[model samples]
Target: MSTTTQNRLESRYAGITLEGYPHALSAWFIVALRFVMGGMILFAGLGKLAFVSGEPFDASGFLVHGVDPASPVSGLYAAMASNVALMEIINVVVPITQVLIGVALITGAFVRLAALGGAMQMAMFYLGGWEGQWLAAFDSTLIYALVFLALGAFAAGRIAGLDRYIEQIDVGGEPLVERFPTLRYLLG
Candidate 1:
């Protein structure tokens, strides 16, 4: 049977108080979300590498023409597209990085780092694929970025994932995270 926990969360900043809000959530639900997100990302990377179009993955065309000209970073995209060396590097890096991030999230290894990377990638995609209307640009990439951020904030990996084990790894007779406190930023 799955269990839910009640939590009261609050925050304060700039002389304003965000009152504690009581909420109930199931850890299993978070694990499921993590799995679904990881699987989708993994498949996306694999699809790129598998190349259903029988052509190597390339970002040049997308960078040059797919992006909306009115996007704030359109010039940056065009510059990147025009640089042969950079494009080549990007072509090879994107899919591999996606795969790595997917695996890390799935396995719950270095989840914070993976989440950060995933969020950054999604942010870039959100900016790159803007469709002109600033207010109407709430898209999948932005949602994905938020999801990644939430996962990191909640330390989802610790809730039934390898991160729970990794955090306890013994280092010189003490738990790894405890021994190196800063590792908390990367592990959970």
Candidate 2:
């Protein structure tokens, strides 16, 4: 049986109480979510790497015409598509970065950094595929970005991931995070 603990959260900003609430979460659920998300992203990268298509991947066409014309960032997408060097860089970087992020999340290594990258990618996708309607704009990309943020905030990797052991590595008789406090921002 899972045990429940009482936890209170409070936050204030600019002389105002933003939030004061009690919340509970299941540790196992978070771990499962991480795995599922990682697998989905991994397969996506693999697909772009020719696992799904027999031909090479190209983002120029998507950047040129796939984006909704009414989207706020359509001009940006068009500009990106117009640049040959940038397109070449993006075509390779997108898939490779996705694979790296997926591996990091699955192995529970540098999860915070991976989550940041994932969130940023999802944000770009969300903006690139803008639906023009406010309600329609809240799509899977937005949800994925939020989920990545939540994973980083909760340090889900430590629950049953390699990060737990990584965090305990001795560095000059002190834990790695203790020795290098800045690492806490990258690994969790």
Candidate 3:
């Protein structure tokens, strides 16, 4: 490529050239994804619970609309939406889970676990809701799933998150977090 073209391509963004430093965007992207996804989940749950706006929120709408009549699991989601007993249980669980996951991702605490949980939820949604168009409209759920897993695998929370502080604690000559194998696996 011509020097002028190269220079133009390497133009400074936010004062740093991204020419040979693609990962520079990694940190920013992760933080942005974390906040955006976390905020969306948090606000969604809070809205459902009417924690801030006093507007009524219910999972019934999601349950009702999530499934396509032609989809294989449509009967299941439909049944869950229609059945009072199951709906009663799910109504409380879904919102609380979303809120907790949102808090974890936002605070960068137990982010791996949160992301994994979020991924599982998204996968379930995909299985039940997507039916046929897995790539067009419902791909975002899998995207969420992958991003969450990537954040966990990279321990992105430690970059600018509470994990940095939490990881510093030592107990009995070992990090307090080391005591929990699951946490170590997740955070690492």
Candidate 1: which stretches are off by over 4 Å? 2-5, 19-25, 50-54
Model 3 scores what on Cα lDDT?
Answer: 0.73
Candidate 2 at residue 13, lDDT? Answer: 77
Clashes of 3: 0
lDDT of each: 0.84, 0.85, 0.73
Stretches of model 3 off by over 4 angstroms after superposition:
1-22, 53-56, 134-138
The C-alpha RMSD of each candidate to the native structure, in angstroms, is: 2.2, 2.3, 8.4
What residue pairs clash in candidate 3, if any at all?
A: none
What's the lDDT for residue 152 in model 1? 86
Per-residue CA lDDT of candidate 1, range 1-188, in tens? 42364466677899888865443455667778788888888777877784653668998888998888888888999999999999999998888888888998888888888889889989988888997886878999999999998888778789878889999999999999999999899887
Clashing pairs in 1: none
Clashing pairs in 2: none
**Per-residue lDDT of 113 in model 1:** 86
lDDT of 2 by residue, 1-188 (tens): 53466655566878977554344456677788888878878878878886566777899888888899988889999999999999989988988888988998898888899899999999988888996999898899999999998889878778788888888899999999999899889888
Best by TM-score: 1
Model 3, 16-103: lDDT tens per residue? 7654434445667777888887888887777778556576556677768857676667777777888888887887787788899899
